[model samples]
Target: MPTILCQLEAVLRFLSNDPGDPNMQACRDGLRQAIAALKRHIQAGSSR
Candidate 1:
C-alpha cells in the first residue's frame, strides 16, 4: 500500500544517514517492522 511504501521510504532515508550513529539501530528496527507488516499485508491481500 501507499502508506507502507511511504514508511519504507522514510526508513530508507534514515538508513542512508550515518551508519555508525546510535539512531541507526532504531531505524533498522523500524525498517524490519515495516517489511514484516508489508509482507503480512501482501499475504492477506493475496489470500482474499
Candidate 2:
C-alpha cells in the first residue's frame, strides 16, 4: 500500500512542471484525491 502511495506521489511530482492544459490539470487533481484517500485508509487501519 505504501509502495502504491509512493509511486502516485512520484508521478504527481513529475507532472508538477507540465503545461497548464485542462487534461493535465484534471489528472493532477485526480492523483491528489487518490493520494488523500489512500492516506485516510492507512490511518483508519492503524487505529483499529
Candidate 3:
C-alpha cells in the first residue's frame, strides 16, 4: 500500500502542479474527487 501510494503520490503531484486547461476542468474535478476518496480510504484503513 505504501509503495502504491508513493507512486500514486508522484502522479498526484504532477497533476496538482499542472496548469490544466479550462476545457478539462471536469476531468480535473473528477480526479480531485477520486484522490480525496482514496485519501479517506487510506486514512480509514490506517485507523484500524
Which candidate would rank higher by TM-score, 1 or 2?
2
Which is the winner by TM-score between candidate 2 and candidate 3? Answer: 2
Query: Which one wins on TM-score?
Result: 2
Q: Which stretches of candidate 1 lie over 4 Å from their true place?
A: 1-20
Off by over 4 Å in 3: 1-22
- Screening candidate 1 with a backbone cut-off below 3 angstroms (N, C-alpha, C), the clashing residue pairs are none
lDDT of each: 0.77, 0.91, 0.70
Range of the 10 consecutive residues with the lowest summed lDDT in candidate 1: 1-10
Best by lDDT: 2
TM-scores of all predicted structures: 0.58, 0.87, 0.59
lDDT of 3 by residue, 1-48 (tens): 567666766675666665666645655677677777888899999999
The 10-residue segment of model 3 with minimum total lDDT is 18-27
RMSD of 2: 1.5
Compute the lDDT for candidate 1. Answer: 0.77
Q: Which pairs of residues have clashing backbones in candidate 3?
A: none
lDDT of 1 by residue, 1-48 (tens): 567677787767768677787788777877877787887888898899
